[model samples]
Target: MKINHVAGARRLAIPLAIAALTLGACGGSSDGGGDSSDSSSDPSKFSINLDDCNDPDSATAPIKGTFDVGYSAPLSGPVAGAVELATAGYDARIAAENAKGGIDGVKVKVTYKDDAFQPDKAKANGTEFIESQKVDALATFGTGPLSAMVDDQNAACTPMLYPSSSTDAYVDVKQFPWTTTILPLAKNEAKFLVNLIKDRFPDGAKIGIAENQTASGKVQSEAFQAAAKAADLKITEVASDADPVAAATTLKAKGVEVVYHGGVTGTCGAFDTARGRIGYEPKLVLKPSNCVNAVEYVAAGKAADGVELGAFGKDPNAPENKDDAGVKEYLAQMKEAGVPDDVIGNAVAVSGWTQADLLINTLKQAASSDDGLTRLSVMEAAREQDYASPMLINGIKWFSQPDLLTGIDGFRPIKWNAADKRFVPAGDVISIRP
Candidate 1:
């Protein structure tokens, strides 16, 4: 319910102090030893006894072992498009990891059930994940309509589930223990929008927020409003219409200068037309969710222009992503596997992949010791530190966010160039150094 932009470095970082991250707690050593010479001196270290595949001395092994991760998403529901995109991202990520010899040479087992984009299903899957499958932890579990399962995850005492949903309430780590987000927090995006508006628009500029009536959209709208007010900007109105483009046209006619909208890719495109219709140009800030692939949002040439959006996560097309540790490799694997590269890049798949990536690392750490290889160990690993994925916000490394109850709420403020059909970071995000 809030949209504004501000710039600053990350204030809090995961305590990297030795005390905060106990060497034996996760059973792995974060400190890099002197050299391979010393490791070779103890031939026993080469016996392939540890869980960390990061061991450079030996060849990464294949999936001789088995562990499970679960997913809760809408395979059938209204937001199925978004859910599908995320699922594809997950599958591609899995295929890539498996192709390169799974974590610790053990293949990861991903099991999933569709929540039909329904909350009941999400809750149900959460229970199953914690009790039955006994997975190391949940990964990229789409909240769908579930809002969240922080209490459920905590009640089940599960480890962090790298979540893709963005509910600002979960920013607090003290509450939710079993999930992390990849996108910059929605509140942060809102804050970012504020700065953008002040710098772009002049005095007496009318700003309005038109968002989908969903809880997420409403939350974004409010956050935008609060930030706008803090910056001494005036909000023209808040419209609950389900259609963004139509609503955008009406709001523009009402003399709106900046429009903040929370809608799907389709609705956001309509906002583009609203600008031309009114003959008055207004800066448009879209919810980060709509900032992704223009394949859908900007279908026709020149349909979407001057659209300011909030990206809740990484830009799939960033050049820096080329050198990302595993990106090229993932793309190669997907290509060889005959899976559509686009499928792998889909939002759902990205969330799934993000979830899988963090879980794999946690599993390695949890399995470090012979005695503590239970779900509890994995849970602890999820809590101990943040997972820095290649596609996360600039400064923020996502661990299990305890706030939003689910893994949603991770987002960044990004802008879209209708000409290029790409997402670029609109402003700086505050977080730890990668």
Candidate 2:
């Protein structure tokens, strides 16, 4: 994925984009109170009209034998290192599930493809999976690629299960009834950050946000700004790609007491390093969940120390979690799958494992339901999920409703201990109950 490196002037367009993507059809209430209507009791209400697709039967058809799934990920791109681990985790989980006789005695088979994190390639892969291959469902990683193919998935009425994206597009159940994601919503993340800032600085502190230029980055930045405005917290904004040293000086001069970077890994490291070099110490330095990797933060050295991260899963590599049964089982499974020891605890890999587990559980529910293991039943089961996975943080449940698009609405805040080169619990899990 190439960095956009857009100018600060581009910030003006973000609010408009947010209005279209966030406030229009794709997002929930700005107050964080999700749709209260209970529509899950009737599965028929969730069914889509598939008259326009090439083969609508694929969406309504039942499996006679094997349950086929088509998945695509960035297996050969700049993000491949982390994404491939997600693929490995997915493969390992599928293997484990098969050994246990699969979902309701029907073996689950996944056809994997490498999208290379390209939108066009991902769209092609999605079309092939739904129109040609006629797979039962679709799953993939990356927000851009998923956004590219979402229309096709909805058109075919194929269940697009557990796509790894933070974009608000997946949450518009009425617009894209076939799609749902396991990733936390950027809006929710913004709300969480705002609440944290208020709690840490009740007297109020000057805030600054280093906004990334990508579409997803813009969404996050706008979300935080919106939440902050709602809470009466003012924020100064900076482009994430700005000269880090200059950016640090400007922020310090502006009396910014807290700095939040909702961007990619490289920029996060650069900004942290610059702040350290310039001796600009903000009261709080925060990063998104995706930037929690040790290797990515290593370039920032001690500058990365004390940086807080928002995450949903327990870090398997953290020494404190070494005794966790879920962490132990994850390690054992990765080892069993012949994964390199060094790659065992990668966060993206853990997410892949988490997504696959969700898929397996949903399939089991669909298989046992009165509707039987058809595409409609699978989607119905997915929309009504309310369970806890071993891999997620304790007491943090994964759930969904017909109108609630996000599976997890909270994060477990962790801080990077640069000296220890691992993440440790910063505070209790913070969530917004809808």
Candidate 3:
């Protein structure tokens, strides 16, 4: 999970500092000229007019300058395995895009920061990118960190896209017009999980739910309850941040036939360990948030066997996807980027690639539009584009549906095979409505 900044990072940092200083010279003087409600206090002071594509050539004219983007995620934390793999995915995707002469000739430059999964740090990083760096858009990971940056996003008027959080709050079309998600909503995931459970355990299995004590976790908790009720499953108990062993023991004693873990992947690991120790193996279904292809978790030896995981993309190691063009490209890019083999299957890495794919495609659409290169135009393009990538689920297309702000509506079911050390498709891609 070590990042090799050495000289490449320094080269990127210098230009960003210079650009921020140059942009700031005109940004602060808007005290008298513009409306206070807009993201930019003084839109009139922009160095380059975003309304007109400076290139008079054509709709597909090569862009004249660099397209600035910001990225913030946990690079050092409990979820670093996921974050770091995702970060590499972003880098690999960007490299592929840039190699193709970039989007409409404007090379994208990302100012990446590590938020350490801290709310305050996430906000600070978001502020620095939007206000100081003056980036066109910001990409974030995780619900907690994304929530922390909402105010910063509105203030800067910079569009924030591809937040991996499935929380409904992130998709408020009215409140956060500048924000949209790339993943399915948590409630939608809940519905899909419940459907699977109903079909598998037709007799109405007794279920126990466990979640974190955080705000996002609470939202997931409620979604699970509603879904469980819809499926007519009996609820034995619900625990928040309780000792995994104790909780598992209680649920086992109560004859709970299944356990739904609604927290981080670590929580899932804890529950599995507890279940193994107690010799009670119930059907474990994880919310998409906790469902991932973490290397260590996969290597844990039978802890995750038969554990059903919901995700929006194909497994990196899936035999069917191995020869697919997109998966091959992704693997090649990761190898070229020096991504470690052990961390390649992390699900967040797929998310990172999806994020990059959306960003590049949206920028291309915006750059080629009648109203070109403006932040507003980019947001509009993001909302309008029916983007798809090689790595997304077989039938899923990014923003394929017009009504959904979060482009993805479906997820595939994957099961961990501890003996084989890989994830195999558990079922077909399942789409759920909001």
* Count of steric clashes across candidates, in order: 60, 0, 1
Tens digit of per-residue lDDT, candidate 3, span 220-239: 78888888888777678886
User: Worst lDDT window (10 residues) for model 1?
Assistant: 1-10
Expressed as tens digits, the lDDT of each residue in 1-434 for candidate 1 is: 11100112101112221232222222223354644322222222221112322221111122137666676766676566665666565666677677778766767777877776566777888778767776545643333443555666654544445565555665454344334554445666676667767767656578887766665556667778888888888888787647545675678667776777755432345555554554546655555553464555456335456566655345445676767655665566556656676666644345555655666676676667342345544544555545566555545455442112223324345666677666666665533221
Cα lDDT tens digits, model 2, 1-434, are 10111121110001111222332212222343333321122221221334444565565567757888888777787677667667788888888889888877888889988898788899999989987898888987768888998998887778889887777866766577678887778778888888989999999999998776655566677778888999999887564545778778888888898988876533457788888898988989887776755666677888888898788887888777889998888888888889887667777678778888899988988888765787767877787777777788876778876556557856888888888877789898876657
What TM-score should be assigned to candidate 3?
Answer: 0.81
Better candidate number, 2 or 3, judged by lDDT: 2
Candidate 3 Cα outliers beyond 4 Å, as residue runs: 1-64, 265-267, 400-403
* Poorly placed runs, candidate 1 (over 4 Å): 1-65, 139-144, 202-204, 264-280, 310-326, 344-352, 369-373, 384-388, 392-396, 399-414, 424-434
> lDDT scores for all predictions?
0.54, 0.73, 0.67
> What is the clash count of model 3?
1
